[model samples]
Target: MVTSKVKQIHDFGQSIWLDFIDRKIIFSGELKKLIEEDGLRGVTSNPAIFEKAISSSSDYDEDIAQLSKSDKTNEEIFFSIAVEDIKLACDLLAPVYNEEGVVGADGYVSLEVSPFLALDTQATIKQARELWRQVGKENVMIKIPGTESGLIAFETAISEGINVNVTLLFSLDRYKAVAEAYISGLEKRAADGLPVDHISSVASFFLSRIDILVDPFLDQKGLGDLRGQVAIASAKTAYQIYKRMFSTDRWKKLAEKGAVPQRLLWASTSSKDPAFKDTRYIEALIGPDTVNTIPMETLQAFRDHGDPASRLEEDIDGAAGILERIKVAGIDMDAVATQLEEEGIDKFSKPFQQLLDAIERQK
Candidate 1:
């Protein structure tokens, strides 16, 4: 029997997606079990996760060797391997897709466009189109960063009726921007006589990273107890933006045409600060039309002993107060958001290049 904690999360209307992906999880049937047992609805992947998978496992060695002999560049080889994994995952989750009506179980697998192209709107769009085609799965979402250029690519991709997973959003402003991009894309698709109902998108707002970056500043300024406060506060405010955006006349028009609300996704929920509760992020951000993509350790922790409850809606006024407190503590959140955005790109870019280097070494 699934634990009441896990079941309650689903009952509360939030989707729990596994943030990490590997061949072992996929081929060994572990991923399927998570879907069946834990209500795991989706999978998200990036260069960092893929780097660990390919470098740490022997699963991709033969494919890497064969591709090295071809004229394909290291980046191409990497994407090819990632696409294979995505295709396998998409197939595995197909039943859930069929049963859940596109928004539920077996929702989609996300493969990010090259982090190198995060700033190039045209290139990001080009690469996203190629990735969607290469994966060849109806349930595939091309992950685009929420950078300015990426936002543009996101708009174009949605306009072209391609599914998108907008990643790295750290602020309400950024999340709203991404939502607008999704809506704009849907409007464009609707105008062009495309099926707006089929185009899907999610704005991924990372959690623990916010706390990781802000808590220390809070501590140095005699606000150490504020550790783990910024992330939830930021997310709650972001959901308010989500609620307001989707309720607008513009989005209502698109919704009438079958456009799904670009749901807010909580990413990086694994607790980085050992001082905090293991399930801190997950338990706090529980709300409707949202997703919490937990890493394996966090997932198991929640499954084992988590006291899951419907806490997301319990503290709306308090959540707002938390943000105000942070600002009063002299932490400029707009500056923090800017820093996080820059660091997010660099963080992914390093691992992406590392994956390329690892592939080259294998060759």
Candidate 2:
């Protein structure tokens, strides 16, 4: 029997996705069980997750050995392995996909374009298309950072009918830009007489990292009590923006053309501050047409003691108040968002390069 809380979360219209992926989970049928038991609807991955998966496991040994023997570069080998795992995941979720139309509870796996290409619009688009072809799965989403150049690449990628997972967004402005890009892409596809219904996308707005970064600043400024507030406030405001943008006439036209709204996905949701409640991010951000991709720890935390009430809807007034208080406390949110964007890029680039280096060492 599904827990009432979990069912309530689904009833509230939010999708829970696992943020981490590993061969053990996939091969052991654990991922399939999550779908069957926990109502898990999707999966997401990044370089850091991939690095840990490849470096810490012997499960990929045979594949790595075979690729090493083929004289392929480490990067090439990495993509090959990642794509293989994603294909397996896609297959595992295929039944769910068929049951619920294209918008169902499964068959979604995200593969990121190189973090090194985050700033190269043209190159990012090129690589995104290439990765799409390489993965060869309809349920796969090409993950792109929500950088300026990434925004351009996002527009082009969606125009070509590539499903996207726009990652690393930390601000309302960035979210709006991503939504616009999705709309533009769908508009172009419709104009070209392409089927827009098959294309889907999600804008990933990172949650816990905001508190991890801003809470320190708030503490140093004598506001430590505000430790867990910024992230939720930020997400609440982002949802407001999403509502506004998708309700506009422009988006309605694209909607008429069968364009799906780029749903808001919460990432980096694992609690970074041990002092905070483990399900703080997950519980606070629940709403309709949204997704929370939880790390294993967070997922377990929610399963254990989470109160999945309609808290996201219950505290709209307070959520707005918190943001007002944050600004009044002299926090430059835009600056912090920009810093997070740079740091977000750096975070992924380092892990991605490390994954490549680890593959090279294996070779």
Candidate 3:
């Protein structure tokens, strides 16, 4: 039986996705059991995740040894391993992906592109296309950042029918740009008479990281009470944007032609503050047509004691007031988001290199 907490999330029309993944879970049938018993609907992986799985595990040694024998560079070997694991993951989730349901519902895995090319539109597009082809799974979503360049790369990638997961988005403005790219891509596909039925994408509005970045500023400014609250306020505001964007006449036209609205996926949901509830991000953001990707720590916490609720819509006025109050308090949210996004790119890119270096030493 699906655990009531997780099942209640599904029953409320939101999907729960596991934020952690490795070959062990896939091969040991743990991923399958999560799907069966916990209502796990999708999987998301990044360079940091791959780094941890590759560096810390004896599980990947034999495969890495075999892969290292090839003439490919360590980076190439890393992707070869990642693609295979993603293929396995996609197959594991095929039942959910194939179910006839909503236009944009997903049972999928996300594979991120090299973050080093985040600012280079053409390069990002080329690599994303290559990753998409290499993974060769219809259920695979090529992950890209929501940089100025990444937005264009996204539309281009989607125009080519490659699903995209737009990561590292922080501001409402950036989120709107991502939604625009998604709709423009689908519109181009429809204009060319191409099928738009299966193209899936998500604007990943990260949660905990925002609070991590903003909370210090709040404390420094003597607004300590607002410490753990900025991220949720930002997220709820973004969810409102998601609703408005998908309800526009333009989105309606795409929907009529079978295009699915790109859902707002809440990423980085684990609370960084010990004072905050472990499931603070997940429980607060629950809503229809949204996804909350929870790391194992947060997921287990939520499963143990989460009280699910329709709270995304509950504090609309209060959320608006919080953001406006934040602005009046002299913390520049746009600046914080900018710093976090730049750091986020490095945060992902560095691990990938470290993972490769670890593999090189083992080889």
Candidate 4:
């Protein structure tokens, strides 16, 4: 009876959150088993995940059919069902959530605002707040993209005490900006005599996708040896940024008011290429005050044969060197970040519209 590898990860301080969710697991008690057996701490959902769940299965048909009979718009209908699923997930995760006047605790179920709102600051803020109010669950986190406009809404949402999981982050510079926005929001709230305790956030960095975009370029540059290495090195570098940002006098002041530092969460963690180990991302990035939100396949792969360790802070100087060499190779990392951000929005928006179209077919 060896300890489960996924459960063993908790000993090193990294929480394994399921990145995929469908009503099937929630209602079937499979989700609960993951919590109990695998030590799963939280869940994350996106439009693409929901799109696959709803369109590929009959689990959502009755709900969609009933909602269609009403005068509600397709978007309205989708959220109605999405909210119910989120609430269910929140309830399941509530036990692990510590809300005793504490901030930045885990066990949250995240729901994203519309991906289409990523570029519209005001609309992103409006939808984020609306979704926050609609779900009305303390353990539920509303995910906003980390785009330029999304960062504006993120700061505002944090100030308003809405827990946010900032998604689609790519560059180190943008990650720092996201951290600044979180701190600025808490600072504003504390200045206004509002309670800063209990607000939670995680700056999610899309990992494997970084390599997916950069590998071919590396190949052409005769730097194919660096194919799977860049994403891990970038993440290690980002973890260093996290440590520095949260150790400042400014962040310390907020901590005194019970504000918890936003943690760095690894997203898009599943390996896309079969040439890499299934647990390539997870094995390299395990550290405290961090999370790795993995898809079900990766989750199962880890539970079966993954090795758990605290390696995120390893090879610090080497990590920096990897990034520097990539720059010297004439790769514009900033340009790559911008392209990934735009593509990430479209990745979600297309599936979102498809989900809406599927609901329209119900009529």
lDDT of 1 at 154: 93
Tens digits of per-residue lDDT for model 2, 1-363: 556455468778898888989899998999998888777878899999999999998888889889999978888899999999889888887776677555633457899998999899999999999999998988899999999999999999999989999999998888889998999999889999988988889999998888888987887777777778988887888888889899999888888867779899989988888888888888888888888888887887788889886566666777888878778889888998999999999999999999898888877
Clashing pairs in 2: none
Compute the lDDT of residue 116 as modeled in candidate 3: 79
For all predicted structures, in order, the TM-scores are 0.96, 0.96, 0.97, 0.98
Every model: Cα RMSD to truth: 1.5, 1.6, 1.3, 1.2
Which residue pairs does candidate 4 place in steric collision? none
lDDT tens string, model 3, 1-363? 445687689888788989888988988999998898888999999999999998988988998899878898888888888899999999999898988765248797999988778999999999998999998888899999999999999999999999999999989889999999999999999999999988999999998889988988898888888888888898889888888999999899988988888999999998887888888898888999888888888878888999888788877988998899889999999999999899999999899889989999989
Model 4 agreement with the true structure over 200-230: per-residue lDDT tens digits: 9999999999999999999998898899999
Clashes, model 4: 0
TM-score of 1: 0.96
**Residues 220-324, model 1: lDDT tens digits:** 998877778888988988888889999999888988987788888999898888888899899888888888888989888988888776677777898999888
Model 3 global lDDT (CA atoms, 0 to 1): 0.89
Residue 162 displacement (Å), model 3: 0.8
Any idea what lDDT model 4 has? Answer: 0.94
